[model samples]
Target: MAFDEGDAPGRVVNGLSVDVEDWFQVGAFEGVIERDSWGGLDDRVERNVHAILNLFDEAQASATFFTLGWVAKRHAGLLREIAARGHEVASHGWDHERVFRMDRKSFAADIERTRKTIEDCCGERVIGYRAPSFSIDQRTPWAFMELAEQGYLYSSSVAPVAHDHYGWADAPRFAFNPLPWSDLVELPVTTAQFRGKRLAAGGGGFFRVLPYAFSRWAIRQVNRDEGRPAIFYFHPWEIDPGQPRVAGAPLRSRLRHYTNLEKMAGKLRQLVREFAWGRIDVIAHREALRLEAEKATLHRASA
Candidate 1:
């Protein structure tokens, strides 16, 4: 579909994304649940994703799935199903490794493995990425340079909020080129100013813990007030309240991971129904291309 066309002036097309990983793969459970044990765990991803696909269908929305290569290798059929249903299939790295933990070589290999796995699974070139846990931050600004060098068209790995685990609190709240002359657009996760502080408005734990009414209002404020589409994301496990709880996780991790799972699917339905949603490439590529053209034009005029 031509996402660049068919929008009225100033219309906001919000992005809906799903981080395609199982409950056991979440960063909160990393220390508690070893990666080696991932295979033995019961697979709830297919069931959960099928439910999500149905929800999107009901809302007449399309989304981008930032799928893990490990999950894609194990659940290729599910990955294919995401593409068949008209959603964009992108990489979420080979494993759930945080970008900050990997050296340059390891990071390159991880992205290549994921890009190939996703392209092979969905038969589409993967151009977008979201780091595990939003791992890209100020110290690892090279992550953006690497993404550009590795042929990524855009990235949604930065969350412009302060967090112990990951965030670049001062990054642009909306999409912008990370490098002055590169085409690689960095679309940070959505945030809204609240009481003189930036609060997480993008979906995930924030979406689960906060009242649905508040999330709805926050997203609307981004679109209507800020005149920019909000980038909302969630995990399939988020909708599976019955999923097994990790035993050894800290109290804080447990609370963050398990809160309001049952309500997530319904809230997602309402969110999609209430806004115009599309794949990230469909929504952000045009802007990136426009910026590149403007830069080239200015360079020529200056020269």
Candidate 2:
């Protein structure tokens, strides 16, 4: 499925998203900083998110904000502002809890609680979810079911690459029905082929660590070569280089989080200007429509 007929022949409206969590809540800091210490830490999320909103506004792009319940509750005004500005407000689990860390029951409760909190803040039903650190994997076969039960329509949760923290290397690279009996879609984050290997092209530490030109080329490859819209995501804290640094984070984590921090916003502005981007809902809707049209065409041909 493509974005619209108005686009130039070889373009698609890729999915751009923001994972709205504070800097202290990152998985990299999970080891060094206790979760209870979150409330006492400096909160840079609001200003950073506003900067992001302004960036999106300036570029005339819309994106999905997969927000944490804890963040949403504390920054209810910011959540309302995000919704007011025409971007989608979706759910990231409460306080950045990874799915693998929670059992089915706790996972279910997390889904319901977070969804309700986000909906209450934004005054809209939350249909999309992205797991913290892309933590949902084959071990949690019940993850999608829990989301389906909570009334989420799609999840941008799985990462189809090998990683030390989280990656389901065998999952499909694009959006697909993870559950045969339900309509919930599992939209794995984007990846690009390089030297006979698939690398993480969707944002995270990868975006910060890699040169901007490579990221541009990789995304272009995904759009032009694969004929599929890519889903790119990054956290709000990515743009805030001035934020307080976590003291005890490991060296590797420090490198991933801190490298190119000052350059992220400029890179993001270029990204917004150069590409066609939209919310996950819009892209997923187009995919569903494309499938329906294909089925109808096949039926007519068979007849």
Candidate that would win on lDDT: 2
Cα lDDT computed for each candidate against the true fold: 0.89, 0.89
List ranges where model 2 is wrong by over 4 Å.
1-10, 292-303
lDDT, residue 174, model 1: 84
lDDT per residue for candidate 1 within 40-130, as digits (tens), equals 9989999999999999988778899999999999888888899999899999998899999987788989999999988887788899999
* Residue 193 error, candidate 1, Å: 1.2
Residue-level error in angstroms, candidate 2, position 114 = 0.6
**Which parts of model 1 are misplaced by more than 4 Å?**
4-10, 293-303
Clash count for each candidate, listed in order shown: 0, 0
Candidate 2, position 171, lDDT: 93
lDDT of 1: 0.89
C-alpha positional error of residue 214 in candidate 1 after TM-score superposition, expressed in Å? 1.6
In Å, residue 21's CA in model 1 sits off its true spot by 0.5
Assess candidate 1 and give its TM-score to the true structure. 0.94
